[model samples]
Target: MSSKRESPLEVFLNRHDDAAWRETLVTLLPAIHEVDRNAAQVWFHFYPLALLRAFQAAEDPARLAQELLMQGSWYLKDQLDASHTFLYGHRFWPEVKRAVVQLAGGVEIPNGRTLAEVVREVARAAAAERKVDESLTIGIAAVGLMALQQVGSEEFRRAPGEVLIDRRHLKRTPEEVLRERAKDEGQGLFGFLRTADRRWTVVWDENADDRRFKALDKQEVASGAQADKRPWHETDARCTVNEGPIPVQCRSASCGTCWVGVLGGADKLSETEWRERKVMPLFGYVETDDPKPLIRLSCQARAEGPVSVVIPPWNGYFGKYLKRVREGTSEEAVASS
Candidate 1:
């Protein structure tokens, strides 16, 4: 099949403004978010149009993502569930409803909301609560952002190689990955980003003078230094943008170790797509290639746009197995199609 004609979501992502789509999402977001309209607009700038359309009506995509993303924190998950409390809430139906319930609780829970409205509400809530700092939880949010960007942007093309044979939740513990990340922080992804810019800052703690993470992304993130820790913070200090050769692996797509999480730049980075089975999560972060996904494998993720993301400490090649199970269980899959 030639594929159903590109959808409105596709058109919207291509900078095409469909009045119906605009009306749909706009109707859902709170008026409060509308005041700072540009911030909400940023989501449109980075969100993938295709994915947004898919999730707007479907609940599983959004729910499964939340389940995976929230895997790291019981407290956060409870908080999320608390958001549901009464009624079936969002557990069993359209993904948009769950999203609407999750982000727009307390206030802004009136009338009808389109996916775009939900998107705007979410961005505003995220901006408002720069406070909740569970790295894992935040990481999940990053992946969601990435999915949006992947669906809407033109950045994604065909997935590169067969690095990821499957897409599923990786069970590695944070500490496990952290230890591994420590070993390669300087030589892997960090090395790549540093070579691109000297002024770049990667902070563990968003607020810190002379934040450690900053210049490290621009230069070598010194290894073997007690000073260089697993999840280090940038001093928030200023520096010169040094340019150098970025050291990388599978600059073709073999190693899953070079993913980074963008903390600040949602607009500057190139858009992403569901490449090689959405490899990031399989590698251990959260698989998603959203233009603005917080987690991205450095080797696969390239940026022409400016964005600041956290570097995931470790990675692996387990996606192939995951893909096999999914394919095997799927009925009518030709057994080996």
Candidate 2:
């Protein structure tokens, strides 16, 4: 049996646990604007290496991160470039790519440079090169470097220049684009009166005009997409069920596939339920007691008003395994005492 060598970048990433990443995110948050800060949070939830590490640490792991279903193409070596298209900073992907590669290729890992410092340095450099605010590219720059750490420099270099965004969008600045995403068209003076049948727009992809679907008052986000009946799978390969923009399996909370990040209008969604609250942490998506957190199970959360959401590329069930691992560790500790 042969074992592959671990890169220094991978080793560096391993040293930081989930708490370290969350702290680094908070450190970077002040530098990033509101929109990209939300994007960064979603990106962190989407590809949590901590979950991957938990799986690896288990004695008899059921599956690896890549083995999870409906995770999209990003986990594959060839799809690395397209991994972060959902981020607002995607417009500056070229710059982010170069910065990640340069960092990944470094032979020496600086002793005092934590993940936050590394992200800041790369983000500042990209922001300077693009002449845009660090807020725009900082999150995506973090996304790129974290991705390189997860996928390894060998695979990261394999997929170069994919650059999936449309050329028309490239002309606009990230600020202009983010503002457009935050824009909400009023439903009129009588909108509140028309409570039962009111329609709200759920912006699935902020960058595209045709990616939105209408949801009636108090309808689940996934339910609205399922009701669209417009053959969404043709446009997005992940939308395999009901031809909806967001991918889903088992309309109930049993499957974690329908998790989404509310980039805007989180207040408009229904509060969290026991099932959703319990499963979110198990799915390793979130660990929040907040009733209407940014991360939500679309199938479980109903939209009370218009919402802007970002669908993750993958989903899995690791809660049971993780729970067992924790219980085993506890038992071992007690026995040792």
Instruction: Judging by lDDT against the true structure, name the best candidate.
Output: 2
Global lDDT of each model? 0.33, 0.75
Candidate 1 Cα errors over 4 Å, as ranges = 1-114, 117-200, 208-211, 214-258, 265-294, 298-307, 311-318, 329-337
Weakest ten-residue segment in model 1 by summed lDDT = 84-93
Q: How far off is residue 230 in model 2, in Å?
A: 2.5
Q: For residue 315, what is the lDDT in candidate 2?
A: 72
* Candidate 2: segments with Cα more than 4 A from true spot: 1-9, 54-78, 234-243, 326-337
Candidate 2 minimal-lDDT segment of 10 residues: 61-70
Query: What TM-score goes with each of the models?
Result: 0.31, 0.85
Clashes of 1: 50
